[model samples]
Target chain A: GESVGLHLPTLSVQEGDNSIINCAYSNSASDYFIWYKQESGKGPQFIIDIRSNMDKRQGQRVTVLLNKTVKHLSLQIAATQPGDSAVYFCAENRDGATNKLIFGTGTLLAVQP
Target chain B: EAGVTQFPSHSVIEKGQTVTLRCDPISGHDNLYWYRRVMGKEIKFLLHFVKESKQDESGMPNNRFLAERTGGTYSTLKVQPAELEDSGVYFCASSQLTGSNTEAFFGQGTRLTVV
Candidate 1:
């Protein structure tokens, strides 16, 4: 099993503020990384992903940064909203035919209006 | 198109009982996966099925758990003699394509409580 961990278990941010969540992974063989947001009583929803070759990738309101040298991953949400409050997880996929994903302990983001 | 669908969003069973969970993947999806999250733990992979075949089941906890995908469209996971350690949220997911570049869609998950 892969070891992925979050720096913080919970984070509090003000609405309209930018929020950054960080993750550390020990698997050097992992080449693909993804960020998922899971609300209470719901399954994880994909937010953004980055390949090892890429350092950064952007989506509608989110940006995913991958640092292979440090083996760290981070998700940045611009202008956080109440709806953004959820548990965020970072998953790494090893480069192989199986493409199995190992998920890290999640960080709970709380948006305060 | 619909996402992955799981039956019986919640199940509570006595220890040493049998429980079976079902999952219906999206249309044309060839990859199906089962994951579980025990209380206060990370979500762990249980198995993966490619159509009607078991692609990888190394994560399955024990022989007491059985998973089958008969027609390649849907899958079922049966746990016999349920244990308290088996109480958790069971999630099912499907992907249209293989590889890490593709995205996997997840169902709401079935909460299993064993007492």
Candidate 2:
């Protein structure tokens, strides 16, 4: 079955440093991708998203880069904070399949202050 | 505005028992979705509702699980004769039918433990 997966299970970083989480998806028909952050005891929250037509999209402190050639995507958070510690999941929106977001296994980001 | 909200933050039920989880999506949002994450696994989609009609339920695990969204408002998921494998965090989300903002708003989730 075609699925989305994360490159790392966990990543640790200093509070002031930048953090990057990677994901690879197998479904070639997917046209949209999103990044979600889930803290303990909470559901996944929307972080950022990118469309296939674009290569990069930037949010407040976050940036999403899409590499269609490699079927890869990444989320970069600048000046990571302790509050940024959470599990980050990359999801692809399968349009033909009802536009449901297919999520990766997620990468746990631990930011130490 | 209020975001997606799920009822019963936690539940612990014995095997063979039945449990029902609820979700109330944001007002006027016609799209609702149910997803669950078993321990150590990725969040998997269970079903999706477009208003009162079910758009897709291909992700449903089995006949033991049933979901309904009556009146195109709140939705419910009932697990009958629950098994230990049914234990997990059930999350509900909502979004618009079509728009540039394709992001889905998620609830805190209901933690179900089948003991």
Candidate 3:
């Protein structure tokens, strides 16, 4: 089955440093992608999203870059804070599947203050 | 505005027992979805509801799981004769529209443990 995957299972970064999480999708028909942040004992919260038509999108301290040619996406966070420590997941919406978002194995971000 | 809400923050029951989980989506949101995350797996979609009608249930695991949205408002998921594999966090989400362009608001989730 075609699925999305992450490059790193865990990431550790200094509080004031930047962080990047990467994801790759095997389905080229996916047209939309989203990044979600899940804290301990909580459901995932939407952070940012990017469509296949666009290469990059930014929101607050986060930026999502999409590479259609390679079917890769990355999320960049600036000046990581303690609150940024969580499991980050990247999801993709299949081209024909409306309202269905397939999630990838997540990257656990650990920010050390 | 209130986000999606799920009832019974946690539950622990013996195998072969039955459990029911509830969800109340944001007001006026016609799209509701059910998803579950096992101990080490990614969240997987269980089903989707468009108002009172079931738009998609292809992801449902088996006949032991049943979901219903009676009035197009709140929804309930019932697991009969629950097995140990049924233990996980069940999350409910709602969106105003049914598409990738809109965002889905998630609930805190109900943690079910079948002992």
Candidate with maximal DockQ: 1
User: Which 10 consecutive residues of model 1 chain A have the lowest summed lDDT?
Assistant: A1-10
Model 2 spans with C-alpha error above 4 angstroms: A1-8, B99-101
Find the 10 residues in a row with the least total lDDT in model 2 chain A. A1-10
Error of 2 at A80 (Å): 0.6
> Which consecutive 10 residues in model 3 chain A have the weakest lDDT in total?
A1-10
User: Runs in model 3 with CA error above 4 Å?
Assistant: A1-8, A95-97
What are the candidates' individual DockQ scores? 0.46, 0.40, 0.41
Q: Write the per-residue lDDT of candidate 2 for residues B1-115, one digit (tens) a residue.
A: 9889999999999999999999999999999999998874888988999999999898999999999999999999999989999988899999876444477899999999899
Q: Give model 1's TM-score versus the native structure.
A: 0.95
Q: Is candidate 1 or candidate 3 better by DockQ?
A: 1
Expressed as tens digits, the lDDT of each residue in A1-113 for candidate 2 is 11134344889999999999999999877898999999988889999889999999999999999999999999999999999998999988886346687899999999988
Candidate 3 lDDT tens digits, B27-115: 99998999998765788989999899998898899999999999999999999989999988899999998666788889989999999
Instruction: For model 3, name the residue pairs that clash.
Output: none
Off by over 4 Å in 1: A1-8
